[model samples]
Target: MTPSHRSDLLTDALLHYSKKVERKQITLLPQRLAKAAKVKEEARAEFTALLQSVPGTTITAVRGWGEDLVNSLEKTSISLSWEEAYVENLHQLELGRTQLEAPRGGAQVLEVVKRTERARRQVDILERRHRVRQRWSLTTTDSERYLTAAMEKRAQAVLDSVSNLAFERKFMCGLMAKYAEGQTIAKKLSRQIHKLNSKIRRNVKLYNLKRPVIPSSSTLPTLMTFEIAMNPESGLWSQHSVSHDAAFQLKQRLFVLLSLHDRASEEMNIIKRPVCRVRED
Candidate 1:
């Protein structure tokens, strides 16, 4: 065989082998691209599910959840103001009584009588204004005694309600703080995950790499994983349990208080009934 013929045959063989390899690669290209796309889509769907599962995602929702509690707390605060005013009124009433009863200097009998009458009138005015004549008067009617007792009961109810509300308000405040902290953590985690996903997608598209490589810790910022946040050993879960227990305890206390209030109300109603009189012939 001639040297030129042998050279031509070898060249043809090499060219055929290269063409076969290229054809094989072309045939597999679509499947590889489809697999990569499926993986990316799965990652995106997982992240979306995670974000949806997180509670209190919107500020409006958070605010709305606490709105009723806030209103109750505000209403309960009025009891404190009312109590202070009642105390001040009592002090003023006492001061007026002292002034009315104070001894006057030596004077004529007519002058002494006029001063005593004036003091009696002033005391009467104060008694009417303060509406405590029933409580302060030495001679009290049965009806007046009943009214005084009712007022005292009502005042006690107000104080109890205020105390319960104060405790609930404090618990709510702590719960809200925990919620806010969780929300912040959730937002930060979401941002980090999104950034990581974006980085992977960009790297894959730009380099046409078969597998996306995660940068070393030294090169990239560290991310907190969902697994860590949800782990039972973490502080987040422990705090959740603590809050849940506290809420349960508070609920029990409220139930007990409500039952007691109901019982007290029923007793008051019984007390308010007219007494029955039996005649002995």
Candidate 2:
């Protein structure tokens, strides 16, 4: 055969092989695409099923397809809405306020008020004695000195008559009893508040998780944490009724009186250190 003829035959053979390969590839293309699509669909479905099985799974750790599906599942799984939890917490807080504000025995309150007034008068008398002593130190005349001494003696006599140790002891005991009662109530309320706050946080977290496109108007204000709500300066107290304020003030007074009692007991060496049963507020 001629060289040109041989080259032409080789070219025709190569063209035929190329056409056969192209046809084979075109014929298999749909099957390959279908298999690939099936694999993709299976992976997505499997991932979705896994998400559904473990609804509590942290989304950040999940690195795969179907993030939107996971989010949808989360939203659907929320048992309690944030708004409902918030309202429940507010109701619990109101109840606590009411318990604190409820009136105690009228006789006990009257006695405490009367004793408090007498204590104030005693303080005033002591202050007058202190001023008289200062004046006595400055006096130059014997007559003035004699007058100051008589005044001091009379003041001491009045103080002796007014300052009844037994009565004071009874008053301190009453304060201690009130303190214990208030502490118990406060602790119970604090625990309830804490639990409610925890519930609120959990509900809020679940509700907000992977939530898409929340509107500005629909967004709720940030609720105060337990610590913030308990704080005197948080202004949370001002929103409550006057009874709540009075209850708070009463607690403060009880705390102060309890401290004074402890100090007195220590100074007198009559009682050993009192064992505190409750944790400090």
How well is each residue in 34-53 modelled by candidate 2, as lDDT tens digits? Answer: 55455445545554554565
In candidate 1, list every pair of residues with a backbone clash. Answer: none
Query: Candidate 1, after superposition: displacement of residue 62 in Å?
Result: 7.3
Off by over 4 Å in 1: 1-65, 76-138, 142-147, 150-154, 161-281
Q: Write the per-residue lDDT of candidate 1 for residues 21-83, one digit (tens) a residue.
A: 656655454445455455445544543454355453443443343454445435343232332
Error of 2 at 163 (Å): 84
Q: Candidate 1: minimum summed lDDT over ten consecutive residues — where?
A: 272-281
Could you tell me which residue pairs clash in candidate 2? none
Using TM-score as the measure, the top candidate is 1
Measured on C-alpha atoms, candidate 1 has an lDDT of: 0.42
